[model samples]
Target: MTASLELPDRLAAYLQRSGVALAVSVCEGDAPLMFVNDAFTKLTGYTEDEVKGRNCRFLQGEGTSEEQRQPLHDFVHGLGEDSGRFPILNYRKDGSEFLNYVFMSRIRDSSDAVRYIIASQFDMTNAMQRSKIRQNDETLRTVLSDVEQMGREYGLAMMSSAQQLADSVAMMARLSLRDTR
Candidate 1:
């Protein structure tokens, strides 16, 4: 990425103030990082000065499998146009793990050539946890249904026996009354 190519001042200012974690990489060479927003620093703990001219792969670690990163690699190398979305397990500068949902899109020049790739990353840890919680909730519902069914069966058996006993007592009382008469 050459420092000579710069974003328009108005667009740059807007991106700098945006709340989204944004990164722009040049399509040339290894797709080096050319720009990053403040939100990107907040998410990855890296300043623009430290990441400039470097590939954004620094945030990836052991948690990011080769299969998950291959699409990104292909996109960076201009080998794939369909590589747009990625769910990556990335590491922060403090060594903590975060699930990042990244959306990458290309910027083309007037000649229809690729110029830059803009990526927006969102933290997906909470969404993943919510999905697990929904699964657990479904399991709990199944268990509660089983417990209720068992209780109903037991209660019905007890009620049937009690009714039978009452009928027997009524029959014996009538027999004794008839004999006395």
Candidate 2:
């Protein structure tokens, strides 16, 4: 509520009520933050007024590696993949640092134009609840998504038997990659 947010009632309600720290940024310009929930403020020691309209990179000061930043940067620039997930060291407003696992998804409009990047970030330093289970779940989701993509590409090259068989596996990978939601 610290910033003037314009969103649908349902989306606003969900963002406000989410337990996980979440932030949303518009795709244009410096990708300035547009929305941050109370959980985000609590996790970063910054209130809405201080964080809104700023880039999330404010959380990075020293020790945040270029290796970790490159993947995310590529995602934003359309240089590599369509999504980004990585762990990086992030600083809080109080100068304290934490290992942050960031997951970002691009929200595309009906016409397939990306309008926003919604980020879900978690502080790994404090997360201790059966991470194996969570990791497994995430792995499965990634595999399924890959399988879905494989299928789409496979359908185009089913002419040769050996090629078809090889593509079938890739096509399977594509199908498995689908159903991201």
Candidate 3:
């Protein structure tokens, strides 16, 4: 086999053997699926044939906001040379949403002409979930601390005000009682 085929073949074989879920695409004029192993199909429920000639954007749906689309467009256009990463939430064919961390770069031939745009996607839903949990925990901790501090300050203010009121009442009662006696 030619080296071009051999390397990608070996890499695809290794990835399949390792059971890593990933999807790879190459884009020249239009994005095309160059290789997708069993894991990719298993993750997205799309057969290799179904995705071969399609742009990856079809995975997006009405739920996909412009906010998610603009950055990828900017990255692909801004870099010009061809390499960048953007994280996006995308839906599977079954409409299940997952966080995808996508890395894209251009592969150049010997003459350094712009050849292929290679993209690799990693499923980051679990990592993002963990990060969200940690952020929430930190936010809760800060709020609790603020509440505790406010409680202490409020308690001290109430005590000081009560003490002054009690002392004034006691003095008035003593003067009035003494004057009456």
Question: After best superposition, candidate 3 residue 104: deviation in angstroms?
Answer: 1.6
Better of 2 and 3 by lDDT: 2
- Report how far residue 173 has shifted in candidate 2, in Å: 26
For candidate 1, what is the TM-score?
0.67
Candidate 3 residues lying further than 4 Å off, grouped into runs, are 1-8, 11-18, 75-81, 128-181
Residue by residue across 45-98, what tens digits does model 3's lDDT show? Answer: 788888866767877777777888887766544354355666788888798988
Off by over 4 Å in 1: 1-4, 129-181
Candidate 2, 1-181: lDDT as tens digits: 2222244444556556655577877777777888888988998999998987888889997889999787777766555544557788999999999888876766554446665667767678755668854863464354334434444554642333222332333233233323222
List the candidates' TM-scores in order: 0.67, 0.67, 0.57
Instruction: Quantify all predictions' global Cα lDDT against the true fold.
Output: 0.64, 0.64, 0.52
Root-mean-square deviation of every model: 28.1, 10.3, 26.9
What lDDT score is found at residue 60 in candidate 2?
90
Q: Which candidate gets the maximum TM-score versus the true structure?
A: 1
Candidate 3: C-alpha RMSD after superposition? 26.9
Q: Write the per-residue lDDT of candidate 1 for residues 1-181, one digit (tens) a residue.
A: 3444565554456457656577877777778898899999998998899998999899999889998899888777777662367788899889999888776766654455666777767677776587865753464354334333433443432122212222222222222223333
User: What lDDT score goes with residue 112 in model 2?
Assistant: 60
lDDT score, candidate 1, position 67: 85
Positional deviation of residue 94's Cα in model 1 after best superposition, in angstroms: 0.5
What lDDT score is found at residue 145 in candidate 2?
46
Clashes of each: 0, 20, 0
TM-score of 3: 0.57
In the predicted model 3, the residue pairs found to clash are: none
